[model samples]
Target: FLNKGFNVVDSSVATGKIEVSNAYKIADLTDAGAISVGKQLGAEVIVKGKALAKEGPRNTGSKVGSYIADITASALRVDNGAVLGSARGHGVSRNISEVTGGTEALEKAAREASGKIIDQIIAKWSGEVSGGGLIQLTVRGIGEYSDFVKFKDIIQGQIRGVQAIYQRSLEGGIAVLDVEMKGNAQQLSDEIARKNFGGIPVKVIGASANTVEVSLGGAVSAKTMSTPPSSPPAAQPSPPVPAAQETSSFFEADEYLVFSGDRDENGRVGKMVTRPTATNPEGEFLMYHDGQKVWSKFFKAVRSAAASELQLGSRIYFFEGNHKEGVYYSPKDKSEARLESWWRDPVTDNSLVNNRGIVTVGRYRVDVSNAFVEKK
Candidate 1:
């Protein structure tokens, strides 16, 4: 009797190799049940089959009967519900030999059926990968649906260069986010690092020119290599403040910060500075009417809030009202500029929504909205 069962077995030959599992009865391939088994089997693609064996018409009244088998199967991508293509196989007994030739016919039919389906799977995968620069990015440590939601939010908000996020899959407690980013892998990883995700610590563990792996709740190591620190920057004199420049006691500890548009001295158009102790900025305001020398006078307490972000050094930094853009810190010495914000903005409002702007940095933030008083 012909073995009328669906066999998904991998075969090996001197010329080729494939890793397939034992055949399965189509009735047991329930949608949910098949997915679970497929995951355990590490199946890259799934194949479904249907076939039939019948007596060949040529089996005219001869004592030996001829048999033919026709088989077909469909291939599908595991992660996405993408249908690759359908493949079919046909087989006929070479010569009626034993009590029945259907067994041989079925065997031939099964081999051809599997070969065609596997080919369809390979072609579909090749098209997906080599066509539109689609990359397979996997982010691990995503245990639940809510985590996926947050991860999606962070990716869309923090990554600006991504053209699209085509698919997201949760498997083996790992979440895979497939996206097409504009630059190579390293560039994409760096861009993702610049933005704050608020909760989980994200690290780019593996990256190639295309494929990338993002790990959640992981710490990124600091780069050890460095250029010899340039001989200490040459000593430069501080900019000259107007004789009538206001001074404030708040800056007694050198807590003062200065900001100017361009290199200093005299007629620079956007020149501005903050004198933390300045009680009144009227004199400096009239000097450069475009509101230079903002000082600490403009800051009025809108609200007092604490930070709940993971990257912020301390839970302090009162969050000034939400200003998407942070003011530039123009120090006389062009060392790496760092902003130490004292107030923190509660992220429950989704403050870190985009990649281009700074949500929070350092340990201090001034009331930016209130910090600027237009020269009314």
Candidate 2:
């Protein structure tokens, strides 16, 4: 597995004195038991299976030993206990010695099964990264609602290939956001450490395949980590503008974010930086036109009316809208995706539809027809 580029956990690590409630019986472990063991080993995916060797057809001429082995394996994502991929393989070997033949057959079967499992896992990873999959982001140490707001804006402003950010919940100073990005959690976590989010210090506490844990204001000490208040504070309203400033505020135009195209040697899209300076790192699937950044995936702000009606942990869908307006349509792909809520955009006339289970992230189409809540 290490030779195959996977970070494998040593078998010896689980050999003795391991902390699990299953009586340390590997053969009788259930899926939940396997997940607990994986968590102890700090593994993102755990591959576990059984192998069986049985008698095979004898040779015609010579009296030779024959054995056939069957191997089955599965790769599972530890965080959500999702079975990413699985495979089975069989091998046959003939030798004068029965034990040697059985051993060779078992080894061959294990090799074949591992190869198939690896291939399937890699294919699934590629499809998710390119198809705008959702990466679960957990931000801790966010005591202020404004900080939560700023964090969302920071993700929107800095990250590349991010179509939408769904606010899942805020509890105990931890905010859960489901971000749809054209990359994996590791890539997003790396980017979070590099950029500055309005002077807020952010740190990547932990990261898995599709989940990232972030800490605001750097690391939190055990003494400082306390229970949140019984009720969350309401978002503070913006201070009222003076009479003189109110008159001048109308002249300030809405400044849509803009960027310039950055491409690499193969013409693959690079990072879209605002200034394109040496300090700025390039992102993926981003292009700029008229100094305004146009992303391959973008989401409009959900109207206030729509957000108020949304219930926590309920899925929604969008089915109608004009190609023009805030919506961007692509001729090549016309799939309807769940557009994340943007905090900065103006409220429009878009409505909300009460539907679930139909979601397909398009490379270029923006679903402006409706707004809906996501179930955890």
Candidate 3:
């Protein structure tokens, strides 16, 4: 749901399992362990959801099988346990995959419900949903596939009001949408500032009391994010080992994914991390500082490489993670070092994509001989 500008953290089975008996249960973060989760993942807000399509009996519809998916969810601010929004919605799908067992209906339903949940969050944070109508919306930059669909869904399904959406034009990567909403233009702008429809984030440049104008670099506001100005609580750099709270941030991070392997010769461990924000967003970016962070695992692993192939200790960056998992780098030699790991193929029946016949695929990473040509 947060694949857009919102950080996609991995609480990783840590939030535990929240099961409901075929009813929408409003989750209470206070008792559901919200603080531990907040500290674990440096998230501004958290959205929790689930689907129950296979609970009863097998689908008995068409050849592909008919499935109904219902999703109920709520949001919370990590810094302070404050419930932001809660909602439930359902969707119907006939694209059930028996060969690979992927729930298309459930995913469809969840997205439908999640979009509504986000609307509520925006309403709560920006204080707008109830009063708005006929606002001009101009979105430019990053008009990708995901953005188009999500924007369409939001306009079509406003929680309270929004009678019609008239498309003015879509040209030169700029889209002009006329939202027949009930609130004022400023209210609409404030609400748009908080949303990350699908994976596209649009910025509200300025909104007249009468008309709202939004651009694309992904609109963002701390109030809507639920993260106070003092989020992530910068830690002191004295101790090599971080406090328990700091440790959770690393495990919960969605910005840079960190992986661990056996310890290096110098008591260090191999770790691979990626900075999703710095990447090209349009293409795969696999380099340090530019769009990737390699120090923790890349440099440490290379530091322990045969004959110090990376020539360890050229320039060390004050790594983002804790001290022990810190990264070191040398621009000249760091780019050439290769690494390998496992990856899971998507749940699909296509043998071409799932040749291994299972999710886990071993020996994935390989070092390219040529250096990356930096894009201007």
> How much lDDT does each candidate structure score?
0.43, 0.53, 0.40
Query: Comparing 2 and 3 by lDDT, which wins?
Result: 2
Put the candidates in lDDT order, highest first: 2, 1, 3
Q: Report the CA-based lDDT of candidate 1 relative to the real structure.
A: 0.43
Number of the top-ranking candidate, with lDDT as the measure: 2
- Candidate 1's displacement at residue 285, Å, is 60
lDDT of 1 at 271: 25
Regions of candidate 1 where Cα sits further than 4 Å from its true position = 1-28, 58-60, 77-83, 98-100, 132-161, 166-200, 203-376
Between candidates 2 and 3, name the one with more favorable TM-score: 2
Candidate 3 lDDT by residue in tens digits, 93-211? 65446422336667777777788667756765454345443455766653353555456566556423555565656555566666756665666676676765655666667655445
Q: Write the per-residue lDDT of candidate 1 for residues 1-376, one digit (tens) a residue.
A: 1143334434223113333335433332433344444545545455655566778666556777788886655554444423444545778885656435787898898888777656655554454444433455777655444544566666655676655564434445565555655455666778767767777677777765446777766323222222322432122124334344222212122222322222211121112233334555522211111111222232221122222332333222331212222332222121111111122222222244233223333322233222211111
Every model: Cα RMSD to truth: 28.3, 18.1, 21.8
Off-target runs (Cα >4 Å) in candidate 2 are 2-9, 13-32, 35-45, 56-66, 77-84, 124-134, 141-150, 166-175, 184-187, 190-204, 208-210, 215-376
Question: Which should have the higher TM-score, number 1 or number 3?
Answer: 1
Candidate 1, residue 190: lDDT: 80
Query: Taking the candidates one at a time, how many backbone clashes does each contain?
Result: 18, 2, 14
